[model samples]
Target: MSTDNITKEKFVLTITADSIKSTDPRFDINNLGLGDNYKALDAKFQNASGTIITRDYKKGEHRNTNQTMAKLAFQLFETQIINLPVEVKEKFPVYKENVDSELRYGIYSSVEDFNRYRKTREYMQYHYGDGKVFVIYSWNVFSTILFVQECLKRFGEQGDKFILTYREKDIKESEAETLESNVQKELDKPISEYRNPYSRKLIESKNIIFRGAPGTGKTYLARQIAADIVSDGYYDTYESLSEEQKQQIEFVQFHPSYDYSDFVEGLRPRINDGVMLFDLQDGIFKKFIAKARANYENSLKNPEVIEKETLVQEEIISFLNEVEFGVDQFKTIKGSIFYISSVDDKYIYITIPENNIVNKLSISIDEIKQMLESGQEFKQIKDITRFFGKLFATQEYFYNFPIFKAIRGSRKKNIKPTISTEKLKKYIFIIDEINRGEISKIFGELFFAIDPSYRGRLGEVTTQYSSMNSKVEKFYIPENVYIIGTMNDIDRSVDSFDFAMRRRFRFIEIKADSTTAMLDELSEDNKDSNVLDNDALKDEAMKRMDNLNKAIIGVDGLNENYQIGASYFLKLKTLTFNQLWEDYLRPLLQEYIQGLYNEDEIMTTFANAYGYNETAEGEADEAFESEG
Candidate 1:
């Protein structure tokens, strides 16, 4: 039999139909084959001859008949079987391959097809015995071509298809590049190229010694530099800072007794938990350093935005750092930028943002001193302003000024000037006879503290004081403070200054005749016409003072002590005709030139030098005689 007709044979069998009813509503066997059947034979079936057949009948069909019946049974069950269409079945084996190929060629209609292809590949991995077979089954030549096309589409022209794409990597690289550019921009300009002399490059020098004869403005220049640095922002022009910024500056004085406890911070008696204890207080140096660090941190976090609280904290911390204190150990506080005085061992630590940059400068004191001595004029207003602004705004040190108040005749009250609580930027401490003080004895270990290299760092020399029972204390100077000292070279009292102390300051000489032009200008001003208008007279007075300085210098054993100052010439403006003779001219002749003069000749010499006789009494008479 052919396969197509294999289910066509049938068998004749009889069964009773109890009732002609169907379980399904749509179709029933009675409706098709039992049409018009009567109720008399409802539960029974009869053969074509109408004869009853018993269950024990021995008659049966031939062998071919049994086979034909079996075939008919199979045909009856065929309606229950499932079958696919010939066209679908023919393509089923290669369907996934074709779909995957389309996807790989960038022709995917949807992600579902792509996912199915991926799943098929994964399935073949476990089912296929050989890896090569799995690979071949999973990827056809067409599918491989499609995959390459899909990869090219997903990744842009410059993108690498093999590597996984990550947005974070690109973002991080961009950030790194930005940071590098910013850092490079800041480093591009050399510090020395800055026009301001008071900037870090100039102030941080190690060997700077200010030298000049008395009143030549050496110390004044130093003070100006300090003010400029401390009062103004490091990068801002001098005019930019608000009044409050200028007011934040502080000053302190260093002496032989001044120690680390005073400058860097130390423990002092305090009540804690109702018990007396030594509470550690941060010193000026430590406070300043802390401020600098805090400022730096804030700048990093908030950039240019400054809050009031931050400023206050910065000021307080800077003050604490400037003085020596034991509390610094617990807090690990460091020193800030500062300056020191050779006299009285005074030092100040100015707490300002500029100090952070200033601390990094590597300059020597000698170089600064040389710059001042060379007198290379600075022209830029910004430079001058910055130099002066820092000097006044930052910390400074000074010796005690003795205020002599007359209590009674022949007796006086000598009181040491108090430490000034006024803002450092606005104040100037002038030492009239700075060189007269014993430098080493007064400054002690501060000699090195004043030096630039050790000015703002830790682990340098410490100072011990008698008041603290010789306990060592850290000392640091503030950058804002300025020191001005006037020296009389002709005075014998200045010979005790240590060489080291002399080297730390910048000096400028004030020749007695140097100010003749200024004096003439002062004399010519009509605002006070009656006040000695003779430029020639002022010139002569300056010449005499120079002569006096020369004479003193010529004396043996008086090299350091023999330089006369311009201040002595100023006395001429203050003395009356008679007072000049009694207070100055007569005394000088008697003490230094008495043996060389005759009795009558000495009076004549005094008359010529003083420009008046002692006998001239009234002001009107003296004026009339001069005019005549």
Candidate 2:
């Protein structure tokens, strides 16, 4: 049989017999069989004739023409095997090269001989594809028989065990999982177990006004609520929104001069061609609107479903263009823009033109456009009424003034524009000093904005004040936003908050106390001797300090008083026994008496409080010397 031009598909070659039986070394078949073997002569003739065949050679024919057989086998192997797939080829270039070179040599006779084929490719491909192939001399040879037996043993075994043992490597473990678990545990713990009543009420109501004497933790509670809001994943829903539409939260402080310009927007200074020019600058409300617009735009990009502000400038312009020309035409109009005038008589006006004959006299489209373009125009209207109204709403003449047309117009419309409550629910606004600010001045038309009953879902409501020049319209607040405020109860300049403002916030009180777990935790001394005997001792010390504060106020004539809070106690613990008398005890005694009492009075107070005192002002030095 000829090995050349072998095109048999799924072909296998196995040695079945051997004709050489001589043990004599002199009987050379290489010389004899080269001419006598009929099958060998036929294979050579068949190759010359270009006929395809699968050939099996006996041992005598193999040894006689091993050199010619090897050459022909190499050429046949090269043309027979397909090149490896690209991914496999890439990972084992050297193995591929060695396999191609070894096939050219035809030296493989056993599994080990094929493995000598080199390169991880040969090993991977051999196992991954067809089972191992063996080249044996003849069926009767012991070495060839053993090689075939071993190849058969490995052919049917699982390939994965071989791959794991020889091809793949193991990975090292990481500490990140442990660290993440610890962090998650800490985050899962609550900040405080106690439920804050004021926070609960504020959450339930649309608007709540905090009113209380100083030292109450109204602002603290507000901050706590803000923290809870941020941590509880409430704002995560807003994350899907565009940067503009999510602008649901805002905070601004109100003062005597905090007019409409500061709350909405105004024209301010800018340089154009080296000349100072007035540029339109957005106020807190307008700034917030811009942010909401951005958020809305972004939210639209997300795949998730979320609330978005659909109103655009084009819609607003279209609405303005659709209004009919007539005195009563402006009565039914609605949009986002509204004008708020904060005079002694505060009122909100919608941007639409009034229908009354007296109100529609000389209003122009140009004026309306100007109001839309520059927020400062709205500020000017507010200033005109504020100057005429004397900044206080309680003045009878100002309330009755007929010239306050804009203020009267807002009152006539009954509409009060406010941030929608739907917008408020998405973000948080923190006010640093809630009590110090003028609530009425800051809230402007939004007094109604914070009220739940007048929220955005309720639509527009009109109210009439006076009819001097024109009537005005204003819209209601939306439901999505929230307000958080902080206050230092210690400030004295402002009188107690107004009742109307008080009704809009929930108040929570924070007081100095000994029973706090945080205080006990901090008081534990890790150094040599513990200054506190136990949690009970710390509580007693706090009580005594409070008593000392009361005694000081009782003895001192000044209304300005001081309390020995937790901070003072921390400082007291830092002093040595002798230093405590001189630095803390004596000074406290002197402060208690308002500097009226002399050194003896101070020493007596110290002895009364601590049951011990330094012998004299400087006697601690002598006592130290005596002890030494």
Candidate 3:
């Protein structure tokens, strides 16, 4: 009756036959009077189903003759007289005098009996617990210690004894197996993969812009980040990306000329019936979104497709193996001859000759075999001979099958198929020099959709030319398609960025440290390859560039934005100290110091830092004037 014995543990309550009827004197079964011949009390309880249920036996007995307690007996029986609310109001509560406890005591016939009681409740409640209380349900004696509100209110009067009667139920083997199997599956999967740094921010914001000074590796880092997300940690660089992964990525430059007509959907002039007519066409961004969306939706419908490609390929091969062939391998009708060349873990190779057109029929190998067996002539699908080219094993088209059209992430021949697996693919659109283009003009109505809170179809809006394309009246940027844009702070100040576009993107700054690290890598590579005439030259080059950047930053109007990057000095291998300054660094410095009163003096100081000679300085001045 003391609630202090309860401990916080997993809800797995195990009760054995011996625990109910033990030989020990501390817990005597004979005293309880639960034996083979004992009969239950006639007392009954009504359930929601209106079924009148009776107790097998209670701690105190009920006799038909005297209506008094009978001698205790013991025998395990399976049936409950009263329904106990499995719907527990509290969960995992520490039993204390002052605190309300989620832990409740009830007698259950079996684990399944407890589960049934749980199904009728709203909150998640389990019947499993570290046993501190005992329960038994049977026709001979239904004995269990229960915590009831009525008994607790009158604890001193009741003397801490609350007996309940319930029946036992059987547990099925199949039900036990299914529960174990589901638990095993849940345990096998990894909990974290895309949970990398910046992933949460990018996922929430949906759009991010990487802005920094030139040569800060903004473009390189963007591509790496995009590759990482798309490949799901399988790839992090351009060279590491698979052909399919490459398809999920797109790179473009934004300039003054870039517009909505080129970036999104727009009306284009087309020659229809020998007359010029305007036709609505989707631009790169829209097309990319479609591809990403198709993959995303397909992934949901077929999640196993992500890692189960080999199984699909095997199915295709097994189906093809059943095809009946006469000679020279498995040849299709219509003279489009093809045979299974080989089969590997990842691909099913089908060899077909150049002249052997394998189109006209658009179906799986199983379907074709069935049709041929039924003597059904297949109608030729015109201009589909090229489609069969993808099936040729020589071209790595093993996964292509008629059952489900493959979502090829190839940029070429932007074919819009009815089904796609783009959702499975993390599509990235990298916009270089993003601020160079007019944001309001290029994005147009898509500005609303770019906001992270407004992402997905919920944020869809009608485009400017929505009236022209009935099929695409409303458009939204998909969640899977990540956007990355890079900008040079020197070219366009942060203040110049539109406020409308500002809140939508998470901006990250890349500084001169990135450039220095890049140079260090280049230097190490040159040293290992023995390409440098003098190793010390690399160090001097780094110092000069760093000093040059500081000097530019110190200039009256010029800040870190206008500071020269390491890329300029990275050309040190072929050019000497004087040539590097006179040809590249000096000419560039001249441009930076242009229109200033101290221009000549500043040029002299920069030239001196580069150890410029009188002749080299004269040549730099002449080259600067000619450029102007």
Candidate 4:
């Protein structure tokens, strides 16, 4: 075989594509391929599954080389499979030094556009077709590869964001599985094995509490459950989730002082321009529940209705932004001239400057939204008898119609709007150490709302600060919102959780022995990669954990609640078996036996079971005594 032209591609470092696996008599990229030198080569790309389409360029073979790939790229552009950005010189930053001098790709919309530019005509003609554009919107073959390489490096820096810009409508179903679908399945496989049951239970129950001995990975497990549920089994771990996916889950750690003011809505103090003011603010849970409710309700809405509602809301906001507060004057249906006075989240207040009355009119933003959504734009007020079931008085119509028309006519439609589809999403709210706080105080009215049977409107309750709200609609938890609470069975504060709240949640006991599967993780990516070494450690860990928990249950006052967990055994990663006992296990066990009558005796039994050498310690103590 010839080796002169054999070379690696610049852009595609690895293509572990599942799509390529379906090839008839599937071959690896390393098997056989012609490289830059136009001669047969082996192992041009190192990937096991997918092949590297080597960017072979020869002076005489410009038209023949990579013509198939170049044509496919052009087809993707024509079908709007992936829209190319309008080329800007500044946007294409110079990639790392590939071959001495820096070069940026020359991208043009079409061949005629490419011909108009005289600068890179010679460069384009030699490497690619004389007047054609190729992959990454570049006319030069090498530049196309360089473009992918440069942008891939930058996108890789974004950590969890595996960014791919595309429009949803542009994609058409293909024979091969998408890279996204494949990657999601790969990410979610391990998680589903362990936490899928927990995720399912949380969804079915609506509220769940994981009760376990300390260090049994209750909090960690809750996060995995949330990630699994939120990503629809695509992502397994919380840390693996993209930022947008993470928005569907909320984590809160409860403490002694956590109350309704922190969990639900409350009067929070704030400082304005000079004086201090108390404002009614929705707390974390309320805010998150509201978001979940909106998502759930929006999913149920007719797409056309949702789109129009969005358009009206957007237009109203735009109108508000353009209007000068207390300056812009407009006529009502009754020829009343009102100047815009102020605007809040719900209402837009306006004052008739020429009126004898001092009061300002409060126009309902919701009403205008309803009018545009369901009501018509009649030229006369008599034609509008009623809007959204509210029989508006003549004066009421005078106050609203003019503002409605102004907002209705001001629609710009700038955004490529996205509306919610009928597929409802699950939102998980995980509260760690839920019993640590006074549950009655923290949950307040929410205790009624969170019940599984009464999940939706049936469970609605007036919140503590409902009186302060502009529109006090009954607050309810959405059907899609699930709560996962983790509690240590031995925590003193567990008594603070009332029977009412207890009945609402399905409690599952997580034992020290129950979490043994997590110990399997320690064997991976540790000091030794040998199968025997890893297996030996895992077996030893499982054996010691079993022995220790057996001894723990034997203690009269102690039971499974005080048993040592697999999390403690995970110290086998950095600590010896004896060191693990002396440091983490010993201290925690000592605390459990602090005032017990048989304290020393119980600890001695535990040491013996865990292979701790008390006799060796006794000998060392005796030697020190003799020296003294």
Clashes of each: 104, 54, 26, 1
Give the alpha carbon lDDT tens digit for every residue of 1-628 in model 3.
2223221111111122212222222233323332211222232333234454333443222232111111111111111112223433222121112124233333443534544544221111112224322232211222221222222332212222222222221234334333333332322222135533544445545678877667667777777677767767666577788887888888989888899999887788966337576656779888888787766545444333433443333444555455443233433333345544544343344555544554211123432222222332223332122333322232122213221221111112432323334224467788888888888989998888877666566688988887543123468765567788889886744556778998778897777656464455455545422333345556666766777777777779877766666666666655555677878777767876789998888987776665566774346434432433
In the range 516-618, model 2's lDDT, one tens digit per residue, is 3333533575132334344544565565555655554454453222333444444335543356546665675555455464646744664556434546643
The Cα error of candidate 1 at residue 243, in Å, is: 6.8
The TM-score of candidate 4 is 0.57
Best by lDDT: 4
Compose the digit string of candidate 4's lDDT tens values, residues 379-417. 666544454333545455676778878876776656645
C-alpha-based local distance difference test score of model 4: 0.64
Consecutive 10-residue window with the lowest summed lDDT within model 3: 65-74
Reference-based lDDT, each prediction: 0.36, 0.37, 0.50, 0.64
Cα lDDT, model 4, residue 124? 29
| Worst window of 10 by summed lDDT in candidate 2 | 160-169
Candidate 2 displacement at residue 538 in angstroms: 7.3
Error of 2 at 18 (Å): 99
Candidate 3 has an lDDT of: 0.50
Residues 69-92, candidate 1: write the lDDT tens digits. 212221222232114343332222
- What lDDT is obtained when candidate 2 is compared to the true structure? 0.37
TM-score of each: 0.35, 0.34, 0.49, 0.57
lDDT of 3 at 49: 47
> By lDDT, is 1 or 3 better?
3
| Candidate 1 Cα errors over 4 Å, as ranges | 1-445, 458-486, 490-493, 499-510, 514-528, 534-564, 569-628
